[model samples]
Target: MRQFDRGEIHARLRAVMDRGEPIVMGGAGIGLVAKAAERGGIDILMAYNTGPFRMAGHGSLAGYLAYGDANAMTLELGREILNAVDDTPVVGGIGAADPFRDIGRLIGEMMDLGFSGITNVPTTGLYDGKFRAHIDATKLGYPREIDLIRMCRDRDVFTVAYAFSTDEARAMAEAGADIIGAHVGLTSGGWIGAAATLDIDRACEATQAMLEAARAGRADVLVVAHGGPFEDPESVRSVFERTDVVGYLGASSIERLPVERAVSGVVRDFKALRPRATRTAG
Candidate 1:
């Protein structure tokens, strides 16, 4: 199958928005989950290297805590994702801050492997206080992400960026991110979620700021949201009502483990009941 470039990605996003439905970008850690998302009619798949962590009964955020070789795991997942789904585009989740990687070479390899787009993960936003200060001092955080997005644009690769703040959104947009995603912590209620840091209204408030900031750099830049209070359909709708965000992204919220929790409970109800004959007289 042919891979989609940035233009095709942007056009597809716009078409979804036109339908008055925010595009859904589901994060799948494995092919089984990815195939499920495709059948559900989601617009894109965000396959993160951190995905394997989800399979290990951890949140995708644990990917940031450093489980293993992220780049290595992600490249292997990329192969599986392409093999699993067709026509549905996938945005490769990249830890762009890895200093050992050659940005140019990485982009080329990913494109060759049939990735439709790219996004930064295990992001700098996860750091705080002294660790954040240290990351800044070492120039190994958002700086690397900024430069990586530039390289992607130069190579005409599709790009999606995660921004925890308006400033980060602006930088990514100016660097040619096709999609500027406002991240609001982990999705609440997932089996392994970090706590929701903000309520839906508050997250939308923050997302609005990000959208305005990103638009300043590229007026047509597509805006999306992920994590935090935007967990269910109601919460996602609340966000859309309050902000101009065009869509949402899901990690554990879209994958098998969380659904497994729901499914297990439902199936237990039937198992608890005794079988009874419905026919009385013949």
Candidate 2:
């Protein structure tokens, strides 16, 4: 119900960094998760195209597939997430390369929707091989994401840009991203997560490189690690230890994995309940 300006968001995060605690931006697709995450003192709440799918127990990659309109889904999910938390800064994800909408109008619409800021998601940076080449050739690529970040910056909206490589990181930073999320790969864990891709050590190295690149472009830009081995607190700690990353931006790692574990475990416990006649007296 509350809205935050860019300066206020920066000040809040800066305060967190000064306190020596890693900031956590949690992905929330549903109201309960958003409310709970706010109660847990999350630094940011992110709503994006893939989040609803992930929360629905589907693979997050489904957002990138041709099932539905990605940007429309994000705005819809953003409204739900925004309505849930009282004051947490919610960063709405935009599919920058969506050809159907005017980019500037989309950014304006997100701002008007009570989102505290913006981020790139359902991103082309996740694609590769021939598909990647084709997208790049057609102008529906990472560059459009950078342009989105720049537009947000011009509007004085906070921006957290996700980057899959050092070049991408630097580009986003140069385009005025307030924070750079060094995206290693699809998160690896839980039932629907991607298979273990990079080990912790390797993921740390890659994350460090991307963060460094972001810093190279904008010396004061905040940096965070996301995806790949950064799925759990332990792995995220390693990233903090090895890189200058001050935080983490979690998608599936936040909403899906923990939900999958907790819900299934509780249901299993309920299933294990037996009749009194089948139970032995204590």
Candidate 3:
């Protein structure tokens, strides 16, 4: 109901985590998760998939020029996702050729749609030599990207940086990332490329390494884990148990379910988890 700042989101998430109740925020497709966050008092985090742009190759760059509007169906899908949530900020464009330009377009769209803050996974875009070299020559840093950090900070936008390695996490924190999330089992292409066999062992290893790096850098970062081939609630819970991650993020698991069924299931689960004090005092 209330508009949230970056600090508010981080503090509320940390408070939730401190109480030993793992904050469960859905990754992408703002439709269901945004509504879940608003009604369930849960935090919401969205990671936009820019893989299509990459897959389309340079010739398809025209689509991006129109802010990807040429694909109205995709935009409509995004709208469907956003429509399900109320007052939940929509983080946009995880991997992009020009992050600043993409972010600007996304922010403008969100603003026009009356959405909240924007967050992203900037470093994940540089998985190749060309992008990596661009970052390096610009003195913006690479693998441990910093340009987006600076841009978001300057704009006072909430940002979440995905770090595949401990060093990447530390560097992002040092670069002024508001939230440093560990992308365990995450591939360069996004959730679509995430392996189904991903397990807690790998999740734990990545989380621990990220925690150590964040602490070593003396950075107060809000850590999150995502990109596992989640099969069920137990598997999802296992990831939380193995790591100090405050929340998890991903869309493939939920997307695989019938949209109606998934939405109803999420609603039921939220209701079941409601605190007893708010449960009609029965």
Candidates in order have lDDT scores of 0.82, 0.90, 0.54
Best of the two (1, 2) by lDDT: 2
Backbone clash total for model 2 is 0
Q: Model 1 lDDT vs. the true structure?
A: 0.82
Specify the highest-TM-score model's number: 2
Greater lDDT among 2 and 3 belongs to 2
Candidate 2 overall lDDT versus native? 0.90
**Lowest lDDT block of 10, candidate 1:** 273-282
**What lDDT tens digits, residue by residue, belong to model 3 across residues 1-282?**
334666776677777778887766554443544465457554664534432332233211232244653323234435655666665555544333343446456555653543345444334333447865776666544532456555666777676776767777787777667666666653222323433444567666767788679656655666766654443456667767777766665444433333435557899998789686777975
Off by over 4 Å in 2: 277-282
lDDT-better candidate, 1 vs 3: 1
TM-score between model 2 and native: 0.97
How many residue pairs clash per model?
Answer: 0, 0, 2
Identify the runs in model 1 with alpha carbons over 4 angstroms from their true place: 256-258, 266-270, 273-282
Q: What does candidate 1's lDDT look like per residue over 1-282, in tens digits? A: 447887887788778888888788988888888888899998989877778788767767678775687877888998888789988999887777777888678878888889998888767876778998898898888878888888888888888898888899999999999888898876677556766479777888899999999999889888988878777777888888888888888777788445767678889986787656643535
Best by lDDT: 2
